[model samples]
Target: MSETIIAKRYAQALFHIGQERSKLEEFESELRTLQEVLRNNQALYSFLQHPRITLDQKKQLVNESFQSFSKEVIHTLNLLLDRHREEILSAMVDQFLTLMNETKGIADAKVYSVRALSEGEKKRISKTFAPKVGKQTLNITNYVDRSLIGGLRVRIGNRIFDGSVSGKLDRIERELVSNK
Candidate 1:
């Protein structure tokens, strides 16, 4: 299967496990901590990702590092690691969170602009979006892209709403050409 497929499958499995056990919140926190450790510590991440490392050694290392984890948490980690699918561990965790949020009817919106938005601006934009999205609840993520030149683009799920200056300029140019 494709990596994305594999990642999604793993994410779904974790989400189901969390939901069934009523430990979703705890699982989310633990996975985020694990992902953070992998992200912030280059050596540990490398050690975990190296293909040559035996599963036994990896399990030992993980056990040593996560001595405080409960039995369920350790079982979950060992199951994923034993699959030699550590590369997708972080993405799986992120996707799992996204799945949870989406299932809970919380929208994740992303606004990309040419410049940074102020706190007030974010609130205004989010307010504008919440109604349009047909949901009062939202989680907004922002990014700045100088190349966009002036306007903003908002995306939620598979839909992208673009009103950037560059986009408008292109539309104008296209209209002028079409009129000619």
Candidate 2:
């Protein structure tokens, strides 16, 4: 199976288990902690990714590292590791976060700007996009890229709207060049 699929399966199984036990929030927290640990510790990353290490050893290390986690979390980790599916940790984390956000009915939107957006600017953009996109709330993630030249890019799910001044200029230049 694909790494993303495996990871998603693991995350979904764990999310369901947590929901069944009425510990969904805690499960999300434990998964977030694990994600941070992986992000911050390169050694831990090496250990998890190293194929030379025996599966048993990796499992033991994972268990030991997250020993403080709740029983449910431990069991889920133990189960996934035992299956030798640790490589999907990153995808599992992303899927888990997505599940949490979807459960809360939060839609994600990416806002690309040439500069940092102030709170007021973000608010205004959110208000503007909310009407256009028809989402009740916007989980707007801001990105700064001077290469955009001016104006902004907005991605709402699979839709890409490029209203940037640079984009317009490029299109006009292309048309003029082609006409010539």
Candidate 3:
């Protein structure tokens, strides 16, 4: 099976387990923590995937590293490692968060602006754009991007609402070229 399909399957199974245990948010937190750890430590995955390392050794290392994590999360990690699906761990976490967000009627958005947005600005942007994407609310993460020149660009899922000056200029250039 493709890695994405496998990742989604694992994510769905974990999501269901979290639902059953009334720990969806807790699982999300744990998965995000795991994601952060994996992101920062490139060698960790290398160690897990090393040909000479045994599965038991990898599991033990994971268990020790994440001793504070819930049993379910640890078990899921061990299962993935056992199945040699370590590469899909990040994708699985992303899928799980996506599933949780869908259940909660929320969307994760990245807002790009030339300057840092204030809390009020973020709230107003969320209120204005969330419904456009059929979501109740947005969990907005603002990124200051000077390359935008001015204005904001919001991305949710596969959709992008580009109100940046650079974006507008590009659109106008395209229009002019097409008209020529």
| Candidate number with greatest lDDT | 3
User: How many residue pairs clash in model 2?
Assistant: 0
Query: CA lDDT, every prediction?
Result: 0.82, 0.82, 0.95
Give lDDT: candidate 2, residue 12.
89
lDDT of 3 at 136: 93
lDDT (Cα, tens digit) per residue for candidate 1, span 1-180: 777778788888878888898988887777778778878898987887898989899999999898876566677678878888877777776788788777776788899998788888888887888778776666778899887788899998887888998888888999999999
Q: What digit string (tens of lDDT, one per residue) describes model 2 on residues 50-80?
A: 8899878987897788998998778877777
Task: Tell me the tens digit of each residue's lDDT in model 3 across 33-89.
Answer: 988988999999799889899999999999999999999999999999988998899
Candidate closer to the true structure by TM-score (higher is better), 1 or 3: 3
Badly placed stretches (over 4 Å) of model 3 are none
Model 3, CA-based lDDT: 0.95
TM-score of each: 0.84, 0.83, 0.91
Better of 2 and 3 by lDDT: 3
lDDT of 1 at 66: 84
